[model samples]
Target: MRYAKSADGARIAYSAGGAGEPLLLLAGQGNTHHWWDGVLDDFRAAHRTITLDYRGTGDSDRPDEPYSTEGFAEDAIAVLDDLGVERAHVYGTSMGGRVAQWLAARRPDRVRALVLGCTSPGGPNAVDRGDDVRRSLARPAPEGRRRALLELMYTPGWLATHPGPYRTLGDPTMTPKERLRHLVASERHDAWDALPGIQAPTLVVHGDDDLLNPTANAALLAERVPGARLCLIPGARHAYFEESRSVAGPLVLDFLREHERA
Candidate 1:
């Protein structure tokens, strides 16, 4: 893993692998770089894939300061700058997508292409998960909470075969305060105004049945961003990038390849 110092002197932890044009992989809310372990190989096959542990997760430092998607985008920029990468393709899911919006808007020169999966524009314009879904996730038992999240994330058929650890759910390592901070960061994301200013070629991908980030948000994102394409994976849910990787993966790769800098 490599380290980058953010504008606020926060130590951002990031790693890079494979070979080809640089491709940044941003994770979902409250997750570490390992969240992409399943799809990383696919991305790595044709790109110099990079992943990072957001503040309060994995190896990144957890300072008690306020967290925001904009700040996280700066952290991503720090990682790129540390590696001397001037520009690259960006793929972010969930809260990561929120950060990517800021990255592409705030630093247009640093993004070659952009992909947002199962994410929202946040604030009042975005459709949120239902209150019942949120209440179910707040269940007392850790196992139950994880189960609830997994059920919401993937279909029962997928879950039946792929039992055991998935990195997207709550991490035992995160303190209550750290978890709340991450949630706050995700909740406070409001990229509505910034979407139209993004200059990079953009793709908005989502699962048709996503309960965590409703599929409707995908259309909203596609509409908000200038000339952005939208892809909806059938029979998939929140974790479509993983559950339907066979379909979503290649689509994203083809899109990125099409927009590769010459």
Candidate 2:
């Protein structure tokens, strides 16, 4: 993994592969570049895909500073600037989608097209997982925690066939303090007012059954972002970008290509 220095001199770790136009992939809360491993080749075939670990995750530095979606966007900007890429398509999932909102809104010229998957806009208008879902996610048992997440993230059949533990949730290596910081940063995101200012063509994709992020937020985001299209994958959940990749992936690719510069 190569490194880029953020505005604060934090070492942001990123990896790039494939060929063609640049495509930046951002991971969910507390996750690293490893989360995108499942769909890298598909994206690589069309664009030079780049993935990065958020400041406190993977190979990136863990500066003793508070985190915010805005700061994370800057980290992304640092990566693109470090590589001398003026603009590119961007795809973000979960919290990554939150970061993408700030990136697209705050740095419109650096974004060609955008995709937000299984994510929320945060703030007062965004939907929440409710108390029960929150309770399940807060299970104290490690095994129970993993099982609870797997159940919520994928359909029953998908989990049935894939009978093993996966690290699709938070970064296991992160300390409780680091994870809490990420959760706080994501919770504090408020992009509702900023969405209207985004100039890049946008596509908002989500699973109809995403209780964690609540599928309803997809409509809110699509409605708030001018001309943004929404695609809801039936029978999918929070990790739909991976569980329903065959459907969501091509839709996103088509959207990006539709708006590509000649």
> How many residue pairs clash in all the candidates, one count each?
0, 0
Residue 245 Cα positional deviation in candidate 2, in Å, after optimal superposition: 1.6
- Tens digits of per-residue lDDT for model 2, 1-262: 9999999999999999998889999999999999988778889999999999999998999998799999999999999998999998999999999999999999998999999999998999988888998899889998898788888899999988877455478889899899999999999999999999988889999999889899999999999999999999999998897888899889888888898779
User: What is the per-residue lDDT of model 1 for residues 27-126, given as tens digits with 9 covering 90 to 100?
Assistant: 9888899999888999999999999999888889999877889989999999999989999999999999999999999999999999999999999999
TM-scores for candidates 1 onward, in order: 0.98, 0.98
Residue 136: error of model 2 in Å? Answer: 0.5
Off by over 4 Å in 2: none
Give the lDDT of residue 111 in candidate 1. Answer: 98
Q: How far out, in Å, is residue 87 in model 1?
A: 0.2
